[model samples]
Target: MSYEVTGKLVAKYDTVQRTETFKTREFVIEKSDDIGGRIINNYVKFQCVQDKTALPDKFNIGDDIKVSFNLKGTKWSKDGRENYITNLDAWRLEAAGSLAQTAINNAPDNFVPDAAPDDVVDDLPF
Candidate 1:
């Protein structure tokens, strides 16, 4: 099955040639959220293989990106022992929230002049 996730790109590694015909590249994304006034962070890594290894080259680190990937699993047996591995195989990448950030960045600056003295507290509903 395929899944999608949006997060800030944290780290990207160079493409590695596993074998003569098999090559892969991996990258990490950081997903953070606020819960109960505390910030939680999650780092997820994904792999791109073959021609897709270059998928992340266009985007720089720290860019918010939406990754579309497929969940892949493999079973390996060696010395009568069996092991399984799971990989998030990313196929496509697109810049996330650039338009919104650009719009907010392009807006005119709003300056608020402080006209009241210190300790003057307004009544605000809590």
Candidate 2:
């Protein structure tokens, strides 16, 4: 299943790949105000693919962003102990600007779902 997260752009960097095809950025999102603004205080990072047309040019540090990402799962095992990890693989990063950050949460048309798969039920059915 694909998920979208709205946050702020806290950092940005590009990975070297000949012509620099890989680029990733981190953002800070206010997950919830009710949690005393703790969740939103964390630095959540998102990634942008090689496509230059994926996002607008307004994306900058300290700007509010709404990121759409894919949920990627990972596993770790060490010293007879195993653990699972998951990360948000960002596919699209949108900067909503500071003025629009508050309005984005309530904006009904902010989320746009194109052609996507349905029923992403895992075979393990966790």
Candidate 3:
């Protein structure tokens, strides 16, 4: 499955050449949320593989962006020990402002119009 996240770009790391034909680049983003009147910040890391490794080059630090990625997990066994790893493989990215505008543009065209002004009245009993 795929998931999307929006946050401010915090860091971009150099691409790693794992082998003759494999490469990967990693980047981090910071997301803040308010919970119980307190603010919490989360630093999330995502990776782009092969051709997508250049994905982060178009954006600068502190730029707000939306990333679309796939959740990947791998299990390995060595020396009678088991280990699991997880990765967010990013495939698509765009500026947060453009993302919001795209959502508005894609809204349904059959939206209902507001009631006529003549039909509106102060009918509240309060």
lDDT of 1 by residue, 8-124 (tens): 999999999999999999999998889999999999999999999999998889999989999999999999999999999999987778843664677667522333667456567
- Which residue pairs show collisions in model 1? none
Q: 96 in model 3: Cα distance from truth in Å?
A: 0.7
Model 2 TM-score? 0.50
Per-residue lDDT for 1-126 in model 2, tens only?
Answer: 888766656666654344555644333455434476555355565555456433535566667667777888799999999999876666666656564665566667635334255634346746
Stretches off by above 4 angstroms in model 3 are: 98-126
When 1 and 3 are scored with lDDT, the better candidate is: 3
What would the TM-scores of all predictions be? Answer: 0.76, 0.50, 0.76
Tens digit per residue, CA lDDT, model 3, 59-78: 88988898999999999999
Clashing pairs in 3: none
Q: Mark the regions of model 2 whose C-alpha exceeds 4 Å error after superposition.
A: 16-32, 36-40, 49-58, 76-85, 97-126
Q: Better model by TM-score, 1 or 3? A: 3
lDDT of each: 0.89, 0.59, 0.90
- Model 2 residue 11 lDDT? 62
lDDT of 2 at 27: 36
